[model samples]
Target: MTQQTENRTPERGTHVYDPATCRVGEFQGKVGPHAMLRPVGGGREWQADPGKIRRATAPERLRAGVKAANERAGRML
Candidate 1:
């Protein structure tokens, strides 16, 4: 017999996609440093320097995921 299952792991400090602004909001819900929102175009982006997001354990991976999602959605990110 063959079985298939989906992985439902909760991404930590991952970028959340917002269709309205065509940008990805990172470090959602938390403020002060680390909080960032990057637009998905024009090579322009926003990022927090001294926030938890900066210190996030998975910053690189999260950013990559965000970028991929943005591209898939045809946004800048």
Candidate 2:
């Protein structure tokens, strides 16, 4: 990996935004040079190049939590 890529990855459990896909996900861990990210509601994870990800803003995290909450509510019904 290049020096730039090495510095781009955030620690696990961090929220990140994938500009290429325009989606937000939690940085679960790393697989090879790619970072594994799972969607807010928790589903199949995707591997993204860390160089393309940025830490999610505070608002993004709030929205993700809301989404997860709604998903959880649905499971109870």
Candidate 3:
């Protein structure tokens, strides 16, 4: 990772993709060296390497939104 990438810290609530876990989550904040992220529509938060995560793409965000919606609909059944 370049120095810019390592120093770049996204603002809170921005959606970021963690390639290590192949998951998209909202940037909560940094915890020590790890960047914390919470799943879309709310769920458990996980630690991700700051250098390994980037802002989520449009389609990835849509997929996550759809999944959250489907999960909510399922619970309503």
lDDT of each: 0.41, 0.81, 0.89
lDDT of 1 by residue, 1-77 (tens): 11111322224445444333434444333244333455433244554432122222355446756766778787533
Q: What's the residue-level lDDT of 50 in candidate 1?
A: 27
Worst 10 residues of 2 by lDDT: 1-10
**How many residue pairs of model 1 clash at the backbone?**
6
Clashing pairs in 1: 33-51, 34-51, 39-77, 40-76, 40-77, 41-76
How well does each candidate superpose onto the true structure, as a TM-score? Answer: 0.24, 0.79, 0.91
lDDT, candidate 2, 47-68, per-residue tens:
8878778888888888888989
**Top model number, TM-score:** 3
Question: What's the ranking of the predictions by lDDT, best on top?
Answer: 3, 2, 1
| Cα deviation of 49, candidate 1, in Å | 29
Candidate 1: Cα lDDT at 38: 50
Off by over 4 Å in 3: 1-6
Sorted by TM-score (best first), the order is: 3, 2, 1
